[model samples]
Target: MKQIGVALWLLFLPFVLFTAQAQESKPLSVDVLWQIERIGSPQISPSGEYIVAPVTRYDMDTDKGESQLWLFSPDGKTQRPLTAEGLRASQPTFSPDGQALAFISKRHKDDVGQVYILPMNQPGEATRLTSVPTGAYGIKWVGEHIYFISKVWPGKNWDDIAEQVKHEANSHVSAHQWNALPYAQFDHWLDENREAHVFRIPATGGEVQAVTQPLNIQLPRSSQSASSYDIDPSERYIALVSDSLNDGVSPNNDIFLAEIGATEATNMTPQNRGNDYNPMFSPDGQVLAFQRQLITGFYADTSNLVVYDLNKKTEKVLTEDWDRSVRGLVWTANSRGLFGTIDDAATSRVYAINARNGKVKALTGETNFSGLSISNNGILVGTNDSFLHPAQLVKIDTRNGSTTRLDTFNDALLADVELGTYESVTYKGYNGDDIQMWVHYPPGFDKSKKYPLFLLIHGGPHGAISNGFHYRWNAQTFASWGYVTAWHNFHGSSGFGQEFTDSINPDWVTAPYADTIAAANWFAEKDWIDADRMVAGGGSYGGYLSTILLGKEHPFNALLIHAPVYNMYSQMSADFAVHAERFGHYWEKPEIYRDISPHYYADKFNTPALIIHGQKDLRVPVGQSFELFRTLQSRGVDSRLIYYPDENHWILKPNNSVYWYQQVRNWVEQYATPGAQ
Candidate 1:
C-alpha cells in the first residue's frame, strides 16, 4: 500500500474524461485571467448592517488599475459602489458607531497615500485627515483617535521631515549607506535613518502624537504594516511586535507591551525568542492575545496562540498543540472566544478557539477564506475562493459553519468560460508520506487518449498551492492547452504539519527534489498521460529546485525557472538570503554551499530551460536567473532568458502579466506539443 511515487487514486477517475468530445464552453484563456475583476477583503461594519470591500479592475488601454470600495448589505439584496469610478480606495475600517469609515488613498493633488474618512450614513465626499507630507497608512479608529503608521526621520518634526524627504530626492548622492542588517525589502530600499512608528491624531483634528517613538522600539527593519501593532479598547495599552536582533536572516520579532504614555515597554515573550507577531488586545481590555513560533529561520514554524492576562499578569498558550499557524485574529464580542484562519491540507479555513478551555473547532471548510472581519453579534465576513472560483464576499454563520454569499462579483464573466476539472489526490512521496497533489484536467479532456503533462512546482517551498485561485500561476490555465497540469504539495510545503514543513531544512534541496521528481514519474506512468511530452516549471524556490533538475537526469522535456536563487554566494546580495542564518555563510561553510547551491551543478546542466526574472525582485535577486541562463548557454544547452525590467517578484502589471502568460504558453507548447494523441 506504501508504493513510492505512485498515485493511489487513479481508479477514482473511472469515467472517460466525463463527456469528452462533446461541445464544450470556451476554454479559460489569458484574456479571461486579466478580464476578471479582482475582489479584495471584506470589512463588515460594527453594527453588522453593511460590508465594504474593495473591487479592482484594469484598463488595457491605460495599462493602469483602480480599486474602489463597494458597499453591500448583509442580506445580499442591496449592492452599490461607494466611491467614484476613478478613485482608488483600500483598507476600509468602519468606525465604532458604524457612521464613518477610514481608508488609505491618494486622491487629486496628494503626492503619497493619506488617510481619508468617508461618511457611512451621509453622501458627503471623503475628507483627507493627515497632510504629513511624508504620508500615512495602516490606519485604525479607536476612541477619539485615528492611529496610523508612517516612516519618518527620528527626532524630526513634520516640517523637518518634509525637508528631509525633499532633500533626499533632490540630492546628487546616488549612493546608499547602511550600517545595520536588512537594508532593503522586496522592491524598495529601506532608509536606515528613518524609523517606522505608530502615531495617533485626534478624530476631529488635533496635534499628532508619536506613540511608539518615546518608548524607543522600532518596527521590523524590513517593513511594518497594519499587523505590526494593536491598541487596546481604552487606548491605555499598546501591543507591538519588534525585531530584537540585527541579523536579518533570523527574524526575532518579539511582542512588547507598554502603557500609551509610559516611558518604557515590556518584552512579554523575550525568553523563547523565535517570532511573535500580530498582537491584539481582547474586547474586555484585560487579555492580550498574539501568535508565537518557537523556531527561527524556519518561516513555516507552527504559530501557537498565546493569551496574556493584563490584570493577573499570567500567560498561557491556547493553541499549543493545534499544529496550525493562527492568523486573521479577531475577538468575538464577549472576548470568550476568537475566530482565526489557518491553512489545512492546502486549503484555508476559519477556525474558532475557546478562551476558557483552549479548544479549537473548524468554522468553515473546503474554500480558502481571507480578509476576516467579525461583528459583535458573531456575524463573520471574509473573501471566499477556490480552484474553480474567484474570490467573492461571503458571510459565515458561526453557529452551524454555513456560508452565505454576499456579493455576485464575476458571475456573468465566468458563465461562458469552461474551467477545467480538478481533483485533490494523494501520492506516495518522500518518507512514505501521503503527499497532497492537485491535478487539473483540460476542458473536454479525453482519458481514452494520452495527453502531455505540465508539472508545476510551487514556491515558498512553504507556500503551498492552496485551493484558492491565483493570477500568476493557474493550473487550469495551463491545462487548457491540452495538457494535464499538476501541483504536488511536496515535503517542504506548509499546511501539512510541522515535521513535513521542516523536512527540507538546512539541506534545502534533497527532499523537495525527490518529491517533485517522484511527482513527475507518477504522472508519467498514467495511462492517459504522455510521458515523453512532459514539461515542468516554477518560481523562487520552485525555480531553485528546477535549477537542480537541470543538473541531474530528469524526465522533464524542458524547465521554466523564474526569479530563482541559482548561486548561494550571490544570493547574499538579496534583502533576505536563504539558509544564511541556519547554515552560516558560504565562506564559513563552503562544503555545505557547494553541495547544495545550483551553480555548483552547472557542469551537468543539459535540459532546455526558459529563465524568467524580474529586475526589481529583491528576494531572489535577478542575478541568479542571469547566472543560470549564462551557464545554460555556455554548456550549449538550449535555453532562453525572459526578463522584465519594470516588475517586482511578481508580474503585476496587466500588460506584463498577459505577456508573461503568452510567453510561457508558447515555450511549453513548442517543446511538448499540446493535445491528445
Candidate 2:
C-alpha cells in the first residue's frame, strides 16, 4: 500500500509542475514576441561590383537591436560582415575607389554621429572624420571631400523672431499650462531655427566648411522643410529643395542650383503651386532629374520624374502617363537613359526610361525592386517580396536582363521560419468602390482546420497597406503562430490614385472606418476565417481607427491600440503643428472634428482593449492613450495600458518590440480563446 501511494504522488508531481509553469508564463516578456530582421539603405559601390547595406538583427536573449555594415559581391558568391563592433553603422557609401568605404557610426559616447572610413582590404578601426555636436546625414563623396547635411543654430535674428513668437503664444497662462498649450505652437518653435545646409569636409582630415548659408534664401513660413543637398557630378553646383518663401503652409518645393562656394542660388523649378524634390544630375551634368507633385486642396497628385536639360533649357516629363511616383533614379554610364523604380500603391518595379524620348520599359517584370544602381557591367537592384522581407542584393544583366540574387542580410535566420504568401483580394466597398486588401495565410497552414483572423489597419488615413514585408511586429509572425492576418488598404489610402487618397479629408474618420468594416465583413464570409474569434489592431492612425471600431462594434474579441488618437478636440489642439496644415484647423472645422472624434462616443466601447504607446511618443502623445484608459476604467470596461519608455512613435529597441508583441499575443489569447472574454 505504501509503494502504490508513492507512485501516485510521483505522477501528480509532474502535473503540478506543468500547471505552475503555465501560470508563470503570465505577464509575458519581450522574448516570447516575434522577431524581425531587416536590411535598409542598400548602396552599391562606385565601381558597381559590391553592395553595402545596414543589416539589423534583434537578439531575443539581450533584447537589443544590433546593426552592422554588410558587404556583398555582385554575384552573391561572397558576403560577409564589414564591421563587428556591434555598433549601429548605416548609410554605407563606397569611396571613389572600391577599396575604401565611408559610413556613419553612432558608436561614440558623445551621442553624435561621425563619419568613419574603413579599408576593405585591411579591416580595422574606422578613421573618424567629424566630431561636431549635431550628427551628419546624407553623406556623399565629391572628389576627395565628403559632403553631408547637418543642423546648426540659426542666426541671432531668426532666434529672436522665434523667441518672440513663443512669448506671444504663451501670453495667457493657465493652471494647465503644459496641457493647454497648443501643439502647433511648439512645432513652430522647433522648426524656427532648423534648416538643412550643405557642408563639406576633407576625405582624409580637415575642418568642415559650411557652403550654403541659411540667409542665402529665406524659406516661406508655409512651405515644407528642406533636406540634404546633392552635388553635381562636376562638383560645380549643389542641388537642393527648399520652400524658403512659403512659410510652411504649402507643399510647393523649389529646387535650387547654387554655384559651389557661392551663396547665390537659382530656382530650377519655379512653380509656386506644385512641389518638387530629390534632385539629381546626370553623370555628364547636362541633365537634371527631379520629382514633382501637384497639390490641389488637401490632396497631392501623383509625383512624376522630370528631366531638365541644362544646355537646352527645356523641362519634360519622362513618365507623364505612368500613374506612379518615380522614387529613386540612377543615370546609366552613357547618360542617354536612367534606371529608376516606379512606386505604385505598395508594389514597386524597376523601369528603364529613355531620357531623350520619354519612353519607358519595365526591367523587373513582377518582382518588387528598390535601391537600384547601374554600372558598365550590369545593374544592381535590391529585391524583396514585401516590406518585411530583408532585401537581397541582385545583379541584373543590362544586356539580357537575367537576374541573379546575390547577398542577403538575414537569410540564415529567415531560413529557420517559413513566410506566408500574400494574395491580392478585391472587395466592393461603400458606393461600390473597389477596395483592395492583401491577405497573408499562415505558414505551413493546415487547410483542414479554421484559423483565427487579425485585421491590421495601417496608420496615415493616407497610408496604404503594401505588398512589401514589414519588419516591425509584422503579420508573418502571427501567421507563424497559426493566424491569418489581412491588411486592408481602406479608402483615403494612398498609391491607388489622388481621388482615393483624398477621400478621407473633411470626413477624416468615417470613410476609413466604413472601409475597414467592409473588409471585416468580407473576411467573415470567407471559409478559412474564424469569425467567432477575430482580433483587430493597428498603430498610429490605424490605432485610432481600432479604438473607434471598438466603440462601434463588439465583433472583435480583442483589440490592440498603439499610439491612438482618442480625443479629436484635444488631439487636434495639442497634436503636432503639422497636423494643422495636413488635416486643417479644428477651429475652422469644429463640427467635422467633433463628429469624427472617437472620444465623443467612448461610452459605446464594449470590447476588451490593450493600449500600447511609447512614453516619448511626440507624434501621438501618450496622453491620448491615458485618456482612453481613464474612460474605460470609469466605465468598468476591461482595458490595460502598456507604456514603453525611451521609445518614440515607432518602437526601435529590439527587446521592447519583442516584449510589445508578446503582450499583444497574450492579450489576444486571453480574449480570443474558445468561449473566453
Candidate 3:
C-alpha cells in the first residue's frame, strides 16, 4: 500500500505543474490585445541629422495613455528617450538653431495644454512658456517669439450685438409665452455668444496680442467655426478664413491676409461659396498653397489644391485634373515644388507636383503615407495597411525614392500573430454605380470551409475606408476570430471626387445603404463566405447605417450599432444643435429629414441588434441610441443596449474599450452562430 501511494503522488506532480504553466500562458487581457503605439509628429532637426518625435505607449495595467519626447539619429542605430517622465507630450517643433525643442504638454493637471521648451544639449526640466486658461494651439517658432493661438474675450461691440439678439429673442418669447418657450431658449443661447478669438502670445511669456478680433472679422455662417490662424515665415502677414463681411449669415468663407501689427485685412479668396483652408506659405514667401472645397451639403464636391502667387497676384489650380483631393501638404525645402498625400479609390499615395507646371509624380507608390515630414536629407514617410497593422516610419531617398524602414511600432507584436489578407474588389450597386470595396480574409483562412461574414461600414457618410491601418475597434479583430470582414468606401464617401462624396448629402442615408447591401450581396455570391452567418456593425455614421440595415430585414443575422443616429429630425434638430445649420431649416427640409430617418420605420426591424453608446457622446448624443433601443424593445426585437458612462463619442479609455470589445465578441458568438437563439 505504501509503494502504491508513492506512485500516485508522483503521477499527480506532472499534472499540477502542467496546470500552473497553462495558467501562466493564458491570453493577455482584452485591453492589451490590440494596443499599438507609434512615433507621432516626427520632426527632423534643422541640420537633418536627428529626429525628434513624441512616442506614445498605452499602459494596460494603469489603463492610461502616456507619451514622452524621444530622439533618434538619422541612421536608426541610436534611440533614447529624451524625457523620462510619463506625460502627454506631442507636436515637437524644433527651433531654427536646432538647439532646443518645443512641444505641448498636459502635465500640469489643469487640463490645459501649455508649451514647454527643452534644451537638446543640457536635457534639463522642460520650461513652461504659456500660462493661460484657454490653452495654446498651432505652436510655431516665428523669429525670436513663439506664435500660438489662444482664446481671448471679445470686446463690447460684439457683446452689444449679442445682447440685442437676446433681447429680441426674449421679446418674441413673451409674445408667445408657453407656445414658443423651446424655440426662444435655443435661439437665445445659440445666437448670444461670440466665438473664440485668436491671440498671439510671446514665446517667452508676456502680454499676448490679439491677432484677429472677433467683431472685426466675422465667422462663416457654417456649422464649423475657424479656430486658428497661420503667419508667414517673414512674420509680415497673417492669413485667416472668416465670414465677417457676410454678417455671420453666409455659409461662404473667404481667406483674408492681414498685415502684422495693422488692423487692415485683405480678402485673398473672394469666393462667395466654398471652403478655403490650410493656407501654407512657400519657403520664399512668394506664393501660397491652400485647399479649396467647391461645394455645399453632404456629398457636395471634391476639394482641390490651389496656388496663389503673391509676386504675380494670381491664383492657379495645381491639381486641376486630379480627381482625388490633396492633403497633408509639405512644401519642399527648396520651395520649387510641393509634395502631398492623395487618396484614389482606397489607396493613399505620396505625390510631388511641380509648382510651376502642375505636373504630378507619384512618390511612395500604393502604400498609405501619413505623419509625413520632409528634411534636407529626405522625406520620412509613415506607411501601413488600412485594416490590420500600425504605421511604420520609413525614410525615403529623394533622388531614388528607395524606402528604408526606420522604426516599426508593432513589428514584435505582429511577428508571430497572423494577419488577414486584404484585396481590393468591386461590385455593381442598385443604380449600376461601380462600388469599390475591400475584403479581409480571415487569418489562416481555409477555402474549403465556409466562414462567417462581417460587413464593416465606415463613418463619415463623408469619410472613406482607406488603405491606412485603422487603430480603433477595427475589422482585423473579426478576421482574427475566423470571420471574413468587408469594408466599402461607398458613394458619399470622400477620397474619390467631390461628385462621389456629395451624392448622399441631401438624401444621405439611402445611397450608402444601397452600397452596403450591394457589398453584402457580392460577399454572398462567394463560395467561401457563409451567407446565413452575416453580421453588420459600425460606429457613428456607420452605426446609423447599421441600425437602418437592421430595420430593412437585410440578410444580416446580427447588428452592432455604436452611437448611431436613428431619427434624422431629432439628430439634426436637437441632438446636434451645433450642426443644425448644415441641414438647413428643419421646416424647409422636413420631407428630406423624414425620408432618411431610420427610426421612422423601426417597426420593420427583425434582426437581433446590439446597441453600444457612450453616455457622454456630445457629437452624436446618447439619446439617439436610447431612442433606438427603446423602440426595438417595444417591438419585441432581440436587442441589447450597453452604455459606457465615462466614454465619449470614441471609446478612448482602456478598460471601457476592452469591455466594449468583449461585448462584441460575446454578441458575435451568441447570435452570429447557426440557428442562434
lDDT agreement with native, every candidate: 0.87, 0.71, 0.71
State how far residue 303 of model 3 sits from its true place (Å).
Answer: 1.4
lDDT, candidate 3, at 640: 98
TM for every model, in the order presented, reads 0.95, 0.83, 0.85
Q: Per-residue lDDT of 163-233 in model 3, one digit per residue for the tens?
A: 55456656746443332112212112232243445566666667767667732774332332222356677
lDDT of 2 by residue, 578-617 (tens): 2455557778767777777899887788778999988767
- Model 1, which residues run further than 4 Å from truth? 1-24, 246-251
- Give the clash count for model 3: 10
Off by over 4 Å in 2: 1-37, 60-62, 106-111, 120-125, 154-194, 218-227, 246-252, 296-301, 365-367, 387-389, 397-402, 418-420, 573-579, 674-677
- Candidate 1, position 447, lDDT: 91
Better of 1 and 3 by lDDT: 1
Residue range with the least summed lDDT across 10 consecutive positions in model 2: 180-189
Order candidates by TM-score, high to low: 1, 3, 2
